[model samples]
Target: MGVCTSQNEAEKIENSEQDYQKLDFNRVSTYQKLENIANNIAAQQQIDTIFSSLIQRMIASRQSHILDMLEKMDSKKKQQFMTKLERIDFEFIDSLFHHCYKQDYPDVFSCNVVQSINSQEQNLDLIKKHKVGIVFLCGGRSSRLYDKLLSDIGLPSKKCVVQIMMERLKKVIMIASDNQEIVDYPIAIVLSDQNSEKFQMYLKGKRDFGFQSITFIFEKSLPVIDMKGQVVFEQENQAVMTPEGTGTIFLQLNSFINKFPNMEYIHFLGLDNLAGLPLDPQMLNLICKQKGDALCKVIETNSILDDRIFYFAKQFQTIKDQAKGIQENSQNLGQMCLNDLYLSVSFLNTLKQNHEKALKLNQRYHTIRRGNNIQFEKHIQDIIEVTDITILHQTDDFALLIDDARKAVIQLSNVHKRNLKLEGTQEKDLVEITPQMSYCRREDLKKIENATYPLII
Candidate 1:
């Protein structure tokens, strides 16, 4: 206990020293000039008084660091620093600068991609004319199945998991045709560089799946190597990792926005859900009706031990703004608090209320080390509403959570079924192909065809 206490004390002292170093103002040259400009900008404030005060506090806090940097620099270095400072426009930086120090912003951040709520209402007829885009994030290795995404599963006809998923989606598209209120959308499968060739082969000339349009996009991959410069997996020789997270979907959607600028909604699904049981177009339509930006699908489980369902909460943090040099004490660094928030339709609505800045995304796998061993587990959750998209938390039982279930259903049979099917089954046939396939197929195919034709010539 004594040793632990001493270590804690030492850490506290070290942090304090670091803070003092940050407070030193003599090392900076343009500190005074920047400080004066900030003060002048604040003085000319035609904006909110609170905003002005916040700016003032930030400038004052940063003054010490500026002075410290100036005092330590030589004349030549000081001139260079001033030139750099000139490029740092206070207004432009202020707009992009999220105040991590105060946690003043809300958990959700909504982009103005869609024009306006009123506009959507007025153009309901027009918006309904277009189909929703379906994007599947299928860029992961099928280590669990020990094959590529196109491998045949142990079923009759040997249909791979990806094929089954595509077939099920075809069923949904068929059902959607009867409903004139919704438009038909295409299915875009996102593949990583490693599995592109195999996927193309599986999909080639097979248009019977009935998707309006089927396209593929490549997710960039990174190689994993050991300290000795040996590749981790021979298959992954030049393989890359998955994009940062599912949140990357937002970034990917930007490219299509111009062409389909009027698209009001997008439906995202995981590639592994082979059975495709839970994703109902009607439920998605209902969510759109409720004006939700993003809708998360959820299922209730009898066993509290199930790791799939995520409870949302708000996380708080106080951050130091290095640009403004202001430490606004301790403030809430708001995030969707995963552990505290309950699973319900109401909770979904609550998130949508703050949808402008909130990101509705999922974390796939989490790694943990136990003593000398390491373990990995899937952390899957249902529909994450990104914008004001309404979330329909469809459950089988309404009486189970009568106080909270808004769109819950009750069954006539006495057999109690509380859980709603949330996720589709993962098809096992999708194998993880090596990067060599991508490079080899292009070169080898050309050589074989050319060699065969040369004899005839």
Candidate 2:
């Protein structure tokens, strides 16, 4: 009977312990959930504080639309946007408003713009005097050409535009070396971030097109702004962005000025145009003699030019007019303005001296249509608005522009046939002129004039 009583007492104690354990489990779970809810609320409050400050700044900067857009976004999107808003370059945006929206253009009228009077002998002499550097703007992609670097010459030679260009430079260097001592011309290529990796991979350890001095400036990208001036998102975390502009080339090159300390003038060339020779003696001479800050190559052509090409907004006066704007229609009746430029280092230095002004002045912003969003871009030619530029009016012979594959083939063939004196050759005829054979030397091409149809010289 005593044993039974003891067992009953132990059973009661065990049952009480089990009941306590069950109650403790419920207490812990409830506390855990409440703690998580409190933590989430705290996190949201912190996000609101930071983002509210950003929104206030946006409103202050006249970007209230951005705040409105933020208000309409769901919690997840709002969080994502706030994270990116922290990196928003408010200074660049403000500068855009300061120049573009306010119509605060550089005093282009004060700058001298004159037509070039060629003196080949004088120019050749000047070329020997001034140490010039070549800059290639390869930041743009050619969708129509099916290439990123515009490498294909649309020829059987298997030579690319860059190879041809470098060969031509070598030829020019050789010719210049005959008269005077010189160094291999410095080359600075400005490539966009998208193309830089692929291009650098192809060009790795190639000694930068076989030149001693080469500087690679990767163009920066700016965040894409929607039609409402809000940053556009490609994904939940990825923001859509575009390359800043050709203007950034100068901004970037300024930092690497020490690389080409001996270079007195910079000859800017677009990667696409093969007709214009780099640092052409004639243009170099004009830049040296006229004492002008900048020189622009202008062509008077009625032919349908590419949409990427620039146009003269007005007739050439004492002050050469800058381009009407970027992406003007081909039907616009005006001289075709090539972005190829010859600029004195002194002018670049002057820009550097006025760094703040230069930064704000050069960022010419325009809205590019991208579905519901807009992209902002700047042009190399916009520099003209800030400085005095000489307009070198070139003849139609200088206008072998390539906008598409067919046009490239036709234009390149025509140029080759005309130079080679291949009379019966049609535009569709595929001819290959190795850069080594002749770097656009008429006399050298004459030797291969009678070679053969579909010639590969």
Candidate 3:
């Protein structure tokens, strides 16, 4: 088309209808694929009807060539991926496009009155009584962590992220158990398609790190759309796709909750944060004290970088325009990052009732470009509601993927065995003590020469 600015662009458009196996589908071949799927359905083969409706819509939309591309694949691959085809519901898309975030909700409540703990033993006791569960979110592309292959980046002690996290979990269990009978806690990870298989294989080659078992949650893939609102293809058959954001965890939240029948607390940790505690007693005290539904843990800071974590704590309905900056909250949330969330299991169940309705009410998409095509994605923070929320100040929380990953590593080294300065706070005596540090930047670890002080991490 005249819109193509380059040769590859023109070729991509041409290849869209003529690639391997010739995507140039006639009306007959399109119908044949439909019949094949229908025959499978008639034979009582289980299939998600979502895909059937989606493929039919593609045909009606005059882009039936996408189906031709699939038909060209060998029957074996075709059968295996029959359901992976992303479903596009036009009505949903229309609604999302016209949807406005106007639902006003409550702000985060801080429990400064709840006193801090004096030891890990206290934290352990809270864990035992509450029957807590941990859900780690690692379902990301990890595009920035590497330049090429995943194996390219080196790690400390020749250990990968999974190894470090697993070892830490083992340490936590040992400490919490305190030589008594082992207490089993539920641990779930929401994995992206890119890292799911790799992590499983990586774990297989190594030991379980200490826990007897873990739960793996896989996310669904959604298609990338063009400026014209059409799904873009990545290959002859595969369309460019990304994992449904953090909200995808809602899909498996019930199962994870089921793991701990007596669960009173659930902590959702972003795998990147090395400073967050696996079984923090402070978190335990806050949730119980607040009697909250969905609670987010926020650090108190005025650092410029903290702005990235500031999200709309609650949606305001009846307001025609969305506010550009965050409003002042009980705490300085505008300059605070959402470290993690601690929820009462009962409260979490309330969110698990209706996935579609919850997503429509909470999730919002943002347009961005990846290589050659544009994409619409929702942020994890968008789905989370700060209900009966409590802002717990974590002095030692550290998350990766900062503006400068390398610099963040340097800061870790400096704070290895020392205290860090609070950027904007009157409480000068309070310090973040790391009972354990679970992750490291490979290159930064290499830079440190033989040092005398203890690198508690």
Candidate 4:
């Protein structure tokens, strides 16, 4: 026992394991109380007031264990946690303790039924009638490639990933507008704080890419929790935080979407999806035709698929098993849904309203080790519970997911050999291509047949 710390508290805990077990700890009630206290403290402006209230609540609730833990931590660390108390979610942290330390798992729902769209032409016609916007999900920090976007085909150009995506979006906008010029088409980029500034800087004063209304929304970040469920600090006074799962975007973007009353559908795509053309006219037609609220494009995977690819896409099995209506197909390994999605603005509103129902669908938290700290992560796939979505299953993988530089090189090489039919003894990183080059269509590659290495198109 340290003389500087709570010696009496240490003696009580060490006296008997049974006494610790007997401590009611009623976690659910404790969490409710803590959540209330936290909300009250957060509303206050004064730091001293906040800390005093937090301490008083803990003592009043007879949460001696938490007090003991806080006492064991150095005064400076405690001060840091208390100072940043508003940013921390005590309920979430308490749940993490139940999951990580107590081996308690959240309920998982299984979906077994699969439904398909009957008429594509009908859906296409419906798409033309409704006004659609685009939701670009690219909230992740580029921790791997040292760049936010990378091209597999070595394209020598000043265009960044955002630029390339916008170029494609220009095509999408023209096509969606039937080759006529349109203005104020909504496009929102959901990104993390780490990359939001970089993206805004890159986009500032640049051409709108045929889009007048472009919104940049930052994803919510949560404090990192240690194994003991204590919040971790990155610096002397700064608490480490990671972006919450993609599902939280609805909460963040709901109010923003309300600003555009005419926007009916949201075409969701990932920034890293090099080949996924957003505002797809055909997909819009189909979803609108079916009168579906949401459309999710999932790739059917088998054991033959690469493990990295499997990990990259969230497993469709979780959806099939947990979600009630989806039926299973025994022929394939499982379906994997990338970020390529088309959702109705109405459904997004419904999802935002039923956020609690979405949370109850699954406890998809995974413990990730970042540097010296362990952080819990949640996923957006939880929204499947609330949304009535149409699944578009594809046999071949169309999403050219280029997350890192190494994957960019590998994917680029494959594209050259398969689509361009230009397999030669060339360095992988040296070959260059762009979306404007072929749009991943083989017929478009005819013009590039005679292209040489260090190829720039």
Off by over 4 Å in 4: 1-50, 55-82, 100-109, 112-130, 143-147, 150-155, 205-210, 289-292, 300-331, 349-373, 395-403, 423-433, 437-447
What TM-score does structure 2 among the candidates reach? 0.70
lDDT (10s digit) by residue, model 3, range 162-207: 5555666556666666645544568787787767887777666775
Q: By TM-score, is 2 or 3 better?
A: 2
Ranking by lDDT: 2, 4, 3, 1
Candidate 2 per-residue C-alpha lDDT over 267-286 given as tens digits, one digit per residue, 9 for 90 to 100: 88885665657667667767
Q: What's the distance in Å from true for residue 181, model 1? A: 18
Of the candidates numbered 1 and 3, which has the greater TM-score value? 3
Note the residue pairs that clash in candidate 3.
102-316, 102-317, 103-315, 104-315, 109-389, 139-192
TM-score list, all predictions: 0.41, 0.70, 0.63, 0.70
Give the alpha-carbon lDDT of every model. 0.36, 0.60, 0.50, 0.56
Which pairs of residues collide in candidate 2?
A: 113-320
Write one digit per residue (lDDT tens) for candidate 4, span 1-457.
Answer: 1122322333322212233334445654434344444443433422344465564343333332344444445656666767665455666666666665447553443332244444433232223443777777777655444555632333455455667778777765555457677566667888886667766766775756656778877777776766555666554446667776565676566766777777788777776555566666657766766566667666655434322122323233333633445455534446665567777778766754675765564445555555556666555544544555545545243535443444644555555555656655455534546655433445656645566555655
Global Cα RMSD, each model:
20.2, 14.4, 11.5, 7.7
Please report the TM-score between candidate 4 and the true structure. Answer: 0.70
lDDT of 4: 0.56
